[model samples]
Target: MTATGERNALDPEPIQSRLRALLDHHPDGPLPDAALRQIRTSIAPDHRSRPPSTGTLKERAQRHEAESAAARAELIESIHAVDPTPEGLLEFGRHVRRNVEPSGFASNMGAAEFAMAPGAIRAAAEHLLDTGTSLAEICIGLNLLSLAPRDGDSERIRIFIPLGRRIEGTAIKALGRIGRAGPHLAWAAERTPVYRRLGAVQAIWDLPEREFSELLYALPVKQSADLVQMFSALDSRPEGLQGDRRFARILRDAARPGALEAEPEALALAAQLWDEVRYGRCALLGFAPGEREMTTAGFQALLASPEASASVDAALAATPEDPDLVWLRMRLNRAAHSDPPLPRGLAVRVSVPRPSIATQARTHLLLDGVPLVEAHFQRGHSGRPETVLHDGRGLEALAEPRDVKIGDTGCVEECCGAFRAVISRRGGLVEWEVRDTVLKDPPTTRLTFDADQYDAEVVRAAADFDWEWPARRAARLLRERIGAESELMSRWECELAWTGSWSPDRSEMQYSFYYPKRPSGNDAYVQFSAARDVPYVPEVDDGAVMAVVDRIIADLRTTDPKSTARLSGGSREYAEALGFPWPP
Candidate 1:
């Protein structure tokens, strides 16, 4: 239609290159629809996407290898028929798998429906015996023979053997094709005692009728990599509301139920895909990739956290056998749980060693992810004990430890004292000019601790709150000190801390008082704080520790019954609570 009237030839650029170029753009962004569509196209082929002619010699070799698996299977079958020992068959299967797996893998064209008359396969197989020809040639006739059972109606046995009344259980297993045929394989899987754990895995998608394969297993395990990648991409689909959420959803979905526990071949696919899931190169399921992936792992690791093991334990949780997996989970969870960059300068407390070193720690994380303490801290111990590290290995390396000082005269004593926080972030340290000397840290005596053997230790942190005599002593010391200095008039700091399901908001606060201080070592200002951050209003007199204990009892009357109940045939004088409160 141009003025030149030559009827200019219309040329349309191929979409594949345009998509590849866009995907490879330097500032590569989350995939665009066009590129995603092209990728889908490249994966979904009619006859199996032929390898590009311009592909490298290596690529061509790979492609040829993939297509020639049937040839390998035939050669192996000849060897198998002659000697069917377990080791011999296994070796053949492994060798065949290694060579056959090299094919760039056709996308899972979806599972072959179970309806593919087994009788036809067996007949074609028998036909090969009579014809004295190649299995490849027999398969051609088989493919044609397969047509009747594959496409036509009325389903029936038609297994590998026509004359026999029942199908060979082994032949049935080899037919774990997609669609209706899957149940037959599932039944075989259930019967296979040696690999029965895999049966639970197969039952993961148990069919309603033991029939039609609507969501049949598509693509052989080796051939499913690209398909899984594509599905992972679909799951990672971004929201019009974009950001990290999209990436997160993708990985979460990729880690679905059957993924980690499928067939060896399929399990291998899941692990490979899990690696890509971790790298977070793409978005998933509206989450900012790498979201739930960390939480699941971290949660599992937390059960064996030193603090949980040593202190706040419900039941012992099992740790993963794989330490590297635990480490990966911890690092990722740490990042996923990172606080947003702060707008104000962050403040932290650090304590120096003295008689009983301790300081008031202050922090404003602005995110819920940060732990009040390193709750899962642990250290592994050496059976034969090492020379340097506390655990006889690396401190905090073998297992996490729930160890910290509260308000005790001696260090080990303080470790058992009822306190709010034990492990204070080292960065929060600061010194106030008291008089001639700097307060060693903990408000009262020098914090004595067993400095036996610890290097830059990574401990699982916890609080100690065992009450009775020591808790009584610490309360009396504070009351006697603060009551003497009522004139100082200080800041009112109240933070309701709880462990597990205690309702911090509704636990009736008895708001009590602290007495004035009498100058002990000449520090003018008196520190009027409980050994821990808690709702228990401490007594003004030495007789007062019981009042808070009484309040703990009163709340228990109606406090969610799930929180407290008599373990033994219990009486009035005894009770217990969950978790630790930090005592200064």
Candidate 2:
């Protein structure tokens, strides 16, 4: 049969198996030309024209909701009518198997449970858990038990935790909803196959703080990306590692001697913790008192050891731009620096303005108190004087002695063709070499700085957050408080877009919310304006901003819900990437 015909006639598994065999037979070299042509034809995209979609996204969504509601109603009626007889329940399970799509079946069961009495639902669910023969019946039982969780429901759910992916996934969800499932979830998180442990970790993520912290401390460090995500989630939480000496000890142990070489993820986690401390996102000794001193000493010790330094160098070579590795390199540089003579007259300074509700914190670089770009370039620049060096890390990059491009002319470099500067250090002097300017007579072709003075000023500027804007500070607080991976964010239909307007009086900060999952035309937004102002006052603004965020989250719980759960997870990265009206 032709490849297309075979694909149409047989199951995908057999076709995949055949393809795998074909590739394996020729593992030594490239496949024969005829075979390659055949493979290409088999997997080629179908270019056949088809009718365009008929309805708008809103219309389609409304239709789907109506259908789902009707189907759920029918499921409720069928399950409600089932005689308490075993045979009747078995037949009802068969009915569900025939009608409901597997993808939606579990949720349907849970939704239907809401329409019936808790006792009735629990009794039916328990029956299925205890004696149901089919997978469908048992899954339905698990879903129902999730909503009407009893003291022993978790035990019943635990039975199916190791069955397989589909069953275990449903089982995990059910256990997560049960308050008593902590022990079981922890057990599963540790004992389950590495690939399957993410579900277990997520299930236990919302456990009581004490239990969660204890479990986090006890959990063995693994090299799974899921564990990295778990670490990220932990770092984002305000209470994470705070006043937890035991957990801090666990982290310190992970960073000991060769631990980072064995598991690179430990390094990432360490860097995240260090970043939190450096940025003042968390308490200095919240994890363990004197952690900063311990960490610095450890890093210095690593630098002293040739073998450890080699391993770090190798990792840095592999991922040079990795923020964790970059931070490590910076630390190493700091440790190695000797007291050099202070440069005369030249200084590096930055002006970071308070972000208004409608604007972002614009950072401008200055040399000896003179604006670098604004003072030199007139045309092709935004009068706003916003430079690219917004984050402290950007300033760190600027401090490096290598030739670095700071920012281009405000317009597109390829089109308008304006001059760019290559900032580099030669001997004790730092020089900015200007190139590609349209003006024959530019203001100045070069600007110079003293290398020692430049490095000190940049480092000082990067560490100082005194000039930070209130809106940006509020965003950081929200990230720490709500957590980037919090289940609460998953409930929102719209992602929190970072672009917002500050009221003219700077009294309120408004944020734009976008529905990324929806179609282009249907991706509507709602404005979330908080009562706050520029120049953050910790005492007055923090509580007020949190209250506003709380209100927004509460509103999303009802208005947005699960139907619009997108992958953005309300992360700042996702929001910025969506191309909303971001402030400069």
lDDT of 2 by residue, 98-125 (tens): 5543345563355435567777777677
lDDT per residue as tens, model 1, 406-432: 112112223432222222212223111
List pairs with backbone clashes in candidate 2.
357-501, 357-502, 358-501, 358-502
C-alpha lDDT of all candidate models, in order: 0.28, 0.48
Worst 10 residues of 1 by lDDT: 376-385
* Per-candidate alpha-carbon RMSD to the true structure: 27.9, 21.9
| Leading candidate by lDDT | 2
Candidate 2: misplaced stretches above 4 Å? 1-53, 83-86, 102-105, 108-139, 147-152, 155-173, 191-203, 210-229, 233-246, 249-289, 292-584
